[model samples]
Target: MNPIRDIVILCNNRMAFPAIQTLHSLGRLHTIGLPAENEDVKAFCSVFAAKAGVNLIVMEKLKLNIHLQEIVRINTLKCVFTMTFPWKIPEEIIEKNPNVFYNFHYGLLPEMRGADPVFESIRKQKHESGISVHAIEKEIDKGKIILKKTLPLRTDFTHGMLCTHLSYLASYILPELFTLLHLNDKGVQQDETLAQYYKKPTITDVSIKWEHQNSKSIQALVNACNPWNKGAYTQWNGINIRVLEVSQIQTATEQAKTPGTVLEINENNGLIIQCYDNTLLRINTVYTDEGFMSGHKLLAFGLKNGEQFASI
Candidate 1:
């Protein structure tokens, strides 16, 4: 029988909860909870710490050398794992340990390498996205991949939905990953030529460019930003309007309408606007600073036919 390996997990998200529980149940898992700025993450950590038979240590730093030193002094440390950790581990720790430190990334590495890969994938309308298990290196998300599991990227998946799905995927994959690590498997190196890094999307990045993009692209942007950052934003009569949901409408007529022009508003359709390619995009839901409002409510707020949305 393979000997039980002593593993340390460093994470701060609810996504890590299931994996934490599974590891703890195995009776060889040690966890370090980082102080999280997100309330949901903090709550998960609190609940995990409260559970019986779980060895958890709370720390304020991500360098993890001091924490590891203390663990090594008291117990035999086998490997380290990270899930949705905000900070990077120091180079010395990885250099000393070699392939022992692993990180679970939400993106298919060498393609989407940085923060918010799910959102980036959705915005780009990629056909597939997946989880990657990799050996932690000095560089952020540039580690060699140990394993990858792909899932179809659904057209309707919003930022929140995609994140929830990925978290579940991580939980499902953790046990298999632990087994591989215990057997001393070194992962495959990533190709530098195929690597593409994406930064966290800014408010500007999520803003809709109605004149430059087609209806499908605009809808993709709205779906990508929903339930995470404010959905793709625009302005109507000088009031900031966040587009929460949208759908494209195929039109047979070749009537040319200016991009952002309100082409139709009715009881059946709510609000439909023309896009760059003269395609129609129907606004399903919108949000103002006041709160969530449907497209019909927008009409009541003095939105009229032929009025154009303010462009960035």
Candidate 2:
């Protein structure tokens, strides 16, 4: 009557590391399935499996389900876990018995239900952020929810910080989830009306659209892309630079200048630029050809005061 029998963990990132530990501690872990293509994750999983005395299988991207079939052959009883696993599960794997397959999703399901939820949540300046444990269905993030835990999204939180926070949160919630599974509790269905699948962010999504976005929105994008894309991008002197960080120092009563125009390059206040709503955003850190440097350094790099940023 044990629901955790014959468990297999399919993981591709460090986010799953804590969950793997929890599963093993519960004496429920069986096999760990890793993506062969990701050398970093594979290396971690290999060492983990050896140290923990567990079965490890490295499956190729296209042959993922085939590897799952192999695991299934060994034992028909099914239970599985997915954490930040990149590839989508084929229908065949779930068609047999879907309830036992649970995915640890980093984002709030049915709402922020797509790729890079970490970035999307921060960039949108979402008031709350959380983790969702759901039964994996054929569709992504549409699975019934087993448990959800949320926390206030901090103003200074970056993509990496939020991700690390949720990983620990996932570990904290897994025991409760296993209890529900033990009772044969099928999770509640998500509301279709509230669901929206966000696509993976593109260059355009990360780029700082100075002409359209306000100071707050632009800063949000900068935070969202930090420790990843470096920052929202723009051009100065026809060379690309990433705005890694920014701040709103003041506001203008009028447009004064075009959005993206450098209003002033101050020694103490740094590189202040105008935004769409006439708000003046002070650039604190940026990435240039010279590597990471202060926004004030843009002037030394030959960008003059009152000059407009080249539109991307």
Candidate 3:
């Protein structure tokens, strides 16, 4: 068997680009999947398309069943790899190479552990989000820190933008981290007290919570649900419309209208609707099953005043 030298990468294409580039720079590379693996193989007939490099092995699908054995074999040598959200890396792997394995996570570890981490961060409207490289342990995201970089959370940042920024950070940090690991440097331990846990989101979790939610809460909810999933929605005129953008009107002349009531519709001002706590939300965009439409045009299309939206 060939003695594996330097990194093996286990990540999707966009996120893996930096790792692949790093290997290319170091002249040692290996990968689990390639971009073309998803399509029908006959479509990629070119010689350039089908070739696999020594460092770039493309597996058709990732099977957890063989992962532990494969990782054990790889780690026995001096080889290192990059993994994000590993499905199955037995603790035996960690016990064998205690401080070698590392993965990048979007949120501060233990605080946001699970799928949809970017979404959870946006829901809380945190001022800062982080890209963390931690030692891979049996527990979820509860590993020792190798490197972590925090950045300001922009007001307009969606889940997509947040992921892009985090992935960029990972790409920048991983190679340097690998160099350190190669030198036998063990990273710092994480404070278990500071760690928190989050769960994978579900359809119910994405449903809009109309009652007991303020305008800011609603806005946070809207921002958190995009990229992979649509924003929390409600039925308007028997049609589902995902709330895309909303702005609170704090200087309204009076609070005479009930929450969810139509306050006004202007040719330029868009649709103004009452929020739960007497606040006004100027809805700018919404996604209907038929496609997206403006709240202003939705009302202009004859959706009546005082018509209720069904949101649990």
Candidate 4:
């Protein structure tokens, strides 16, 4: 029987929890959970770290070189794994110790690379998105592929749901990855021609374009921004409204109501708005200054049937 290799996991996201558990059970795990600026994130990390039996090394920034040096000085680090860690190690170190570092990306590489790929995929209405495990080099997500698993991108999947699914998938596949490493396998290189990168989603990206975007596009935006972002939003009667959940409804009413116009309100169906493509959008949930509420409550909160949602 082959001996288990000593591995270090560097992570900041909650999605790494399952994989962390798997690594801990393997009994050769050392973990570094980075400090988050958000108070909620800090609390979550504290809870998860306690359960995982990990003493997190909380740092303000992800200076990989400094962390690696300290880790090597203290322990015999044989391999490193990363998930949602914001920084990359220098190429010289990777060259000196080839195949020692690996990263799990949330998107199928060569197609979608960089931060917020899952959001980008949903925003673009992609039919499929996947996870990739690859060698970590100097260039971000341009490394050689070790193994990959593709999954369908369901139309109704929220950002949180997709992330949870991918994280669980990562936990399932990690053992196979370790076995491959034990056999000294070098991964396949990625094709640069097919590569595209996406930056993190901003407030502007999450804002709804009710006047210009089709119902399907708007629905996609709403699904893509949840749990991680402020969500696709609009203004209503001078109050900012974040649309947390929405569904597209096919309408046969060829009446050309202007986009953003409130077409109807029903006790069960909620606020129905006419979109740019003349299709109806049924909002299910929304966030206001007070808190989250169901769409039907918006009518009682001053949203009228004839009033329009402000594009800005």
Q: What TM-score does model 2 achieve against the real structure?
A: 0.92
Show pairs that collide, candidate 3: 29-55, 30-55, 110-196, 111-196
Q: Model 1 reaches what TM-score against the true structure?
A: 0.92
Name the Cα RMSD for model 4.
2.4
lDDT of 1 at 176: 80
Clashes of each: 0, 0, 4, 0
lDDT of 3: 0.64
- Can you tell me which runs of candidate 4 are displaced by over 4 Å? 1-5, 36-55, 62-64, 74-76
lDDT for position 267 in model 2: 77
Residue 247 in candidate 4, Cα distance off native in Å: 1.6
Given candidate 3, what's the lDDT at residue 170? 70
Better of 2 and 3 by TM-score: 2
Off by over 4 Å in 1: 1-5, 62-65, 71-74
On lDDT, the leading prediction is: 2
- Lowest lDDT 10-mer window, candidate 1? 28-37
lDDT per residue (tens digit) for residues 187-296 in model 4: 88999889998888778888888778988999999999997765787988888999999988987457868889887876877889888977788888888888888877
TM-score of each: 0.92, 0.92, 0.81, 0.91
List clashing residue pairs in candidate 4.
Answer: none
Q: Model 2 over residues 144-230: C-alpha lDDT tens digits?
A: 888888968997888878888888888888778777887988889999998878899998898988889988898899999997888
Task: Please list all clashing residue pairs in model 1, or write none if there are none.
Answer: none
